[model samples]
Target: MTIEPLLKYMSNYIDLTSDEVVFLESKITVRKYLKGQYIVQQGDICKFSCFVLSGCTKTFYMDGEGQEHILMFSIEDWWTSDMGSFITQTPADFNIQCLENSELVMFSYDIIEDLYREIPKLERFFRQIIEKAFVASQKRIVRNFSLSAKDQYLYFRDQYPLIEQRIPQYMIASYLGITKEFLSKIKSQLILEQ
Candidate 1:
């Protein structure tokens, strides 16, 4: 099993002994999802927190009108899950889907709690991760309210330049909370300025 990516991620927060690494490897289940596959669907209980080893995934919600609003994107080395659902063991409000064929390391909530008990450092590591995620989410909310559409597009472009080539423009537009046509106009203006 290829667990190098997960191990590398954990190393940032805590130093794991070989035995701990082995224990982690035994607990995690590696899975692959094809592009367009749904890892967690709206209204279904989210059972696992997943780390993306490769490829991309998007967490999004569909409105009653059937429009998608992307909440977050996860690429290699990133973690993605419906946190509330995973923690509370309730149905998810959003869907997590793969944008490309993806490899993921998944830990069930029970296993994760057990790990936290067995290795307290892992709890701190996850707590730090959640803290960062919360901060980022807050920043995004602020940006959506305060930033201009062009500024939002530019911010996203600067932060995730490679994402444009990986996913469709409409998805990017949705993520930016702008119309696809408006995003195209922004892109055109940017090109003209360049």
Candidate 2:
């Protein structure tokens, strides 16, 4: 895949001049990763912020009991990075793993400041992206506390219809904070109700 997808996605937020685009192309790196490969692992400092040109990835952390709690899933045009680690240059608490053979456009944190300096709107574009992600995260937290498991599952299905088909049910259950069997039962009940 090419950086065209990323450039196009960015256009939805901010227009880039030809010179800015050329500068971006010079600083950006594109890489391919096979399924199950990790782009960032827990405890390692996240050096790059990546945008998916194609395919999917999961960001999660393993608990003390070795249970994995998925934070989010990112597909095409989505951004993935441990923001805390990337911004602070600290060890990451999450691992980002490819769920399919993926192509990503990565911007190194080292060059981000310079990019922002040269392309001021680029910083605004990222700010908006982060703002949307933050709002979604806060909404998810509220949903977890306020909604029943079945309602949460329904909401998830409605919000991520594309994702529901691509990801395994068990992983979806894990993301919903419900057991797989419980998720199965919920799906069955929904079908029966229909």
Candidate 3:
């Protein structure tokens, strides 16, 4: 692959010179995974911060009963990592698995720190990205408390249009914190309303 998507993403926050782009490209390693492959397994150290060039992955936790709870989904152009584990070089609390055949560009911890020191503008870019992730997470928490299940599903649909088609229904149900049967009922009601 091409690093254009990453370059474009960076350009939104800061102007990158040709030399800087080359330097960034040198630090990134591309890898591909089949659907169902685990990028980061729970209890393992997450070695890389992954940027999705194509396809999707989900970060999730497994409860004592072995129920999977989705924490977040990273689609094309999005980044995914166990930030705590990656930064601290500790075991991860979550699992990251590919939901589709995916291509990712990975940056190791050392590479990121080097980038920060070499191109300080990247510090601002990452800071903004982290801030936005935090805000989105906070908004999700607020919506979980404030919105009804059906409304929450609707909001998810609006927020991630076409995502429903890409992933399994049960995964969507899990993400919305609802039973699959409840999600079906909601879909039926929406169909009737339409």
Pairs that collide in candidate 1 are none
- Write down the TM-score of every candidate: 0.98, 0.98, 0.97
For candidate 3, what is the TM-score?
0.97
lDDT of 3 by residue, 134-175 (tens): 899899999999999999999989989867778888999999
Candidates in order have lDDT scores of 0.94, 0.93, 0.92
Off by over 4 Å in 1: none
Question: Model 2: per-residue lDDT, tens digit, 1-194?
Answer: 36998988998999999989999899889999999999999999999999999899999999999998988999998999999999999999999999999999998897888899989999999999999999999999999999999999999999999889889998999899988999999999999999
RMSD (CA, Å), candidate 1 to true, equals: 0.7
Which structure is stronger by TM-score: 1 or 3? Answer: 1
**Poorest stretch of ten by lDDT in candidate 3:** 1-10
Clashing pairs in 2: none
Tell me model 2's lDDT, rounded to 2 decimals: 0.93
Kindly indicate the candidate among 1 and 3 with the higher lDDT: 1
